[model samples]
Target: MKGDLSTLVFTGCETSGCEMSRSRQYDIKRFCFQTWYYDATEGRCSQFWFGGCGGNENKFATQEMCETICVEPPGRGRCYLPRVDGPLRCDQLQPRYYYDYTKKHCVAFWWRGCLGNANNFNSFEECSVFCKDVGPFDEPTTTTVPPPAPQNIQQFAPTPEAQQIDIVSAEQPQQQPQ
Candidate 1:
């Protein structure tokens, strides 16, 4: 793309007088946040790739913000209700896989805390028991074949032909020793 002057944030030549007069000079502050929401349909915290410009009120500035909105409410029913595992960490939970009701398969999600519910499972195998039946997790395999070697191509050459005989001496004169 061609360089656009209108999109330039700083020209490095702005006078102090211009800076003082302008209310907002080169507002190039870019803000990016990982926004998450409790996907009741998926039974996990679904994330969105937000380009921080204009957004809706449901949008949050942090993962905590999303949790406050979607998780804190009583009977929010956003998360999974897995079997009660003792001392489930409500805080400092790690990301793990859970079964998505809508997708009918296992998916990755950041667990917020240890809460006893079938929607929550320690692993995909655990979740699969209560949810839809999914096949065992298998690593993807790849096979590569090397390219063929270059061959020496043979070229054709011209063959020699018979030479023509000169007949001028036979008709003129048989001058032997002049």
Candidate 2:
């Protein structure tokens, strides 16, 4: 039996008269089939070829796809939100536009054929399409409020005729003939 252990080390298993150990007794269906097994060491699902003999208990037939059973992906466990490497460029052969607050309108500008910020748009149409709808510059409305009415306020209109009357009244000052 001691010699059998040595042979098992090289051959992985004894071809004859070797019952599966108690740990591997669960693999009752060890047959020639490609099955998926969770490779805990690599944290992924791996293809395992089951021999028509005794084997380990890690065999799984479609019960463990890599995504569902393996470890979490690069970031979150399930959902993957890609990183924003950089801002969207403007020199993409297609004309682009940007909204200028000073101008109060979408203005056309040529990108320097280099990397640019996301403040730019791919086209004038694209810029105008969303500039009005999604920002502080939507369609404008005008409403006029009349000025307040006069409140006991005296406003004098000194015309030339009023000045002449005042001069005559000054010259013919009140004279009592008594």
Candidate 3:
């Protein structure tokens, strides 16, 4: 209802809608739904609960829609970039994984969920695969250790005679009629 049809088409990466903060109606009659929004500061899409009434153009039905509308595709050397925890204004602790160029491996970090960099990943495996070629020159070796054998609990069990004695003691004799 505001911009022309050209505004609907994504011609460039920059979108003011992406930069807008998420909003939700605070009224008692508010109806909330989960939605995705492009976090321009973090350069990624994130989920947020939206109140059905008042929201901005930043809201999207899915992560894909948000990305297609606002996020720029990953470029070369993305893995080499430093990890970002995003802005402190949002203060949502999200556990994330990122490739550590110095360590030559993926490590865990707490993402503030608003404005981090593309180096952030949802899992260690995701980070490893994405930046596999960017790390150490030599492939890291891993040693697999078999799990310990199950203990023999039979030794702790009571013998048949002991069990029988306990059962007999536990039984009460029939009471005579008064």
Candidate closest to the true structure, highest TM-score: 3
Worst 10 residues of 2 by lDDT: 76-85
Candidates in order have lDDT scores of 0.37, 0.37, 0.58
Each model's backbone clash number:
11, 0, 1
Please state the error at residue 51 of candidate 3 in Å: 45
lDDT string, candidate 1, 42-97, tens digits: 33344665556654344444665444434332221322222222232233334455
Q: Comparing candidate 1 with candidate 2, which one achieves the higher TM-score?
A: 1
User: Which residue pairs in candidate 3 have backbone atoms (N, alpha carbon, C) closer than 3 angstroms, thus clashing?
Assistant: 42-115
Candidate 2: regions farther than 4 A off: 1-94, 134-178
Candidate ranking under lDDT, highest first, comes to 3, 1, 2
Measured with C-alpha atoms, the lDDT of residue 39 in candidate 1 is: 43
For model 2, residues 8-58, the per-residue Cα lDDT tens digits are 322221121111221233344644566665443233345655654655534
For candidate 3, write residues 1-178 as lDDT tens digits: 4433234422222344655776565343456778887665566788987777767777888887666555433442445445666654654456787666667777677666676556778876787788888646333354212122222211133467765422122134579999
| Candidate 2 lDDT (Cα, 0 to 1) | 0.37
